[model samples]
Target: TVIRNAWAGDPYPIDTLMMYMSNMAWNSSMNTVETIAMLTDKDEAGAYKIPFIIYSDAYYSETVPFADLVLPDTTYLERHDCISLLDRPISHADGAADAIRHPVVQPDRDVRPFQSVLIELGARLGLPCFVNEDGSATYRDYADYIVNHQRTPGIGPLAGWRGKDGGSIGKGDVNPDQLQRYIDNGGFWHHDFSDDQRYYKMGNRAYLDFAVEMGFIPCAEPIVFQLYSEPIQRFRLAARGHGKVQPPDAERGRIEAYMD
Candidate 1:
């Protein structure tokens, strides 16, 4: 959910907020918000539905007129759990689930436990109709499910589990005891496997995750790629035949040398 932080006064127009959202890399998937509105059309009718943005501080300033029942959740202190799915391998953390996220310190507003609110919401929504039995969505140990599904070779469970004794990592690795080996070798894995079908590289594909990461495509045109390489502007970094510069200017064997 992208909640844009409103200023004290001189409130900005909705168009401004919309433009701000369109320009930023964070909310590039503008359609996700629309999709949410579309998906819960059955449930919400004309009311706003749940937003699914990675960042929560983006939707604001008269844009979401359909918003109803706003729930103000706390920062790190109020959360009883956490998640650990790093899109890039470089950002790994241990015990990503457990972070001492208890309410021992207390809050300025109504002081209530996090678990209670979740249980209440579940009862109201009537989700997971079978297992919950009461035709409600129970708090199904989301933290546990997160730890189990999002394991990425190093991070382990929150409680009742010990990390590698020899400083190795394993939870997400394909090899057995690889996690342990990583620990023994000071957090490093020596994978000996050669290139297989999994390493498939195609010149061009219908779609790619990188297109999103690079911000070359937006949610409005999720299936389309923006013209990053204008033929009018030549580039030396591009490969021989792939250079965007049109013929006679920077095409193969035409110019004395393709300048950077």
Candidate 2:
């Protein structure tokens, strides 16, 4: 959808396309030839159809050539990373868990961590969340943000060893030494579900309650499975010209064909 949006200029034309670690020109693309064509294709004015592109990658992959700016990134062994609970968590059917990656060795080159670069970029752009009330940068780096930035009052990227003294789990106050706590615990944290919360998760009362406590769900209501999705139907209806926002003529056919 991102490629399609940039290629067609649907809704509106974009000024810049920023990508991180995505190899759309080759490995990640379903049709590499078509993807490359779309990436390099120019408009009538000789401007690229997708306009400017900024890409960050640890290695010089095939997609780097298409980018207008290439921000070199640090390798995994030289950067801090989190397999966060708020993002793609490492969870199983019986329990939920999260992990982190701490740099074992410092980089010998001049490359910086992509996450830290992005954080600096966010601050430079004066994003509301990245700036303080006095208009100063709120976080010094990615590690600073990880420890103090709360998505909600008590919830953050990690789900374990929370609170001021690092005794709480699931939800609590921000812990300044969260990264150290993760490091001390073998770079990971796991929460085991009780017997009642182990199976039939969607409709299980105990599981639902636990999910709410962990800020995974809004409430403790059983999640009802839907065979038919209304959002998908809405898009299909829009393809038939039944909405305030409709797809372009070139895209209507594709939407109708695949929306089902």
Candidate 3:
């Protein structure tokens, strides 16, 4: 229902939205609203008033009917992706881990990985990060970006084999054959923490140190998990006319009630 939430109010707020690997029919709340809006709405210029929706899916699904553009994405086995610490990394408390999906077979249809498409689109839009000084595309594709784009000066999205020779792990120079390294290592890479570094991760100095090495956090600072959030309290205070940012009149009551 995030798409519908983005489409809330009399005039739709978003200009463009791309759905990746999502089933809109499964969207219990947003599907009907999105369908009605997309089919019937028009702008002052006689163009479709609703946000231009681009739905992407590997299989032919019920959501295809609503898309202005249907970008056919390849199956997972036919694409390259990295499960990095940035998103939901498949890591256990014992170790920081990441994995890669290497295309096992060629796609028979005109399909591409969404990550490659996004990179190309970013280049087309001339986004500074995705373009060179001469306005050429920085990285050729998602795999190229994975190998070259450093999250920090030396650290990147992948924690696996890195460095000029593909011999190092964690922090190192970009390895051109880094993807190959992952492929060779059974499609995954892991860094196991020591016995003392396994539990009490939020406060354990050793665990925090390893987390920093793996780019999980900036520093090995102990984290205090919040039970009552100050940000929520701020929203409540705003509802009572006490802050620069104020809640809408309709939402004020709900916000204030949640504060207590």
Model 1: per-residue lDDT, tens digit, 16-52? Answer: 1112223233234355565334423432364222332
Top TM-score hit: 2
Which runs of model 3 end up more than 4 angstroms from their true locations? Answer: 9-12, 27-51, 248-254, 257-260
Local distance difference test values of all predictions, in order:
0.33, 0.88, 0.81
Ranking by TM-score: 2, 3, 1
Q: Residue-wise lDDT of candidate 2 within 67-149, one digit each (tens)?
A: 99999998888888889988899988889899999899999988888889988889899997999888888888877888878
How would you encode candidate 3's per-residue C-alpha lDDT over 153-242 as one tens digit per residue? 778888788889877778889988889988998989988889999888899998888778766689999998989888777887898999
Cα RMSD of all models vs. native, in order, equals: 15.6, 1.8, 3.0
What would you estimate as the lDDT of candidate 1? Answer: 0.33
* Winner on lDDT (1 vs 2): 2
* Candidate 1 lDDT trough over 10 residues, lowest sum: 7-16
How well does candidate 1 match the true structure, expressed as C-alpha RMSD? 15.6
37 in model 2: Cα distance from truth in Å?
1.2
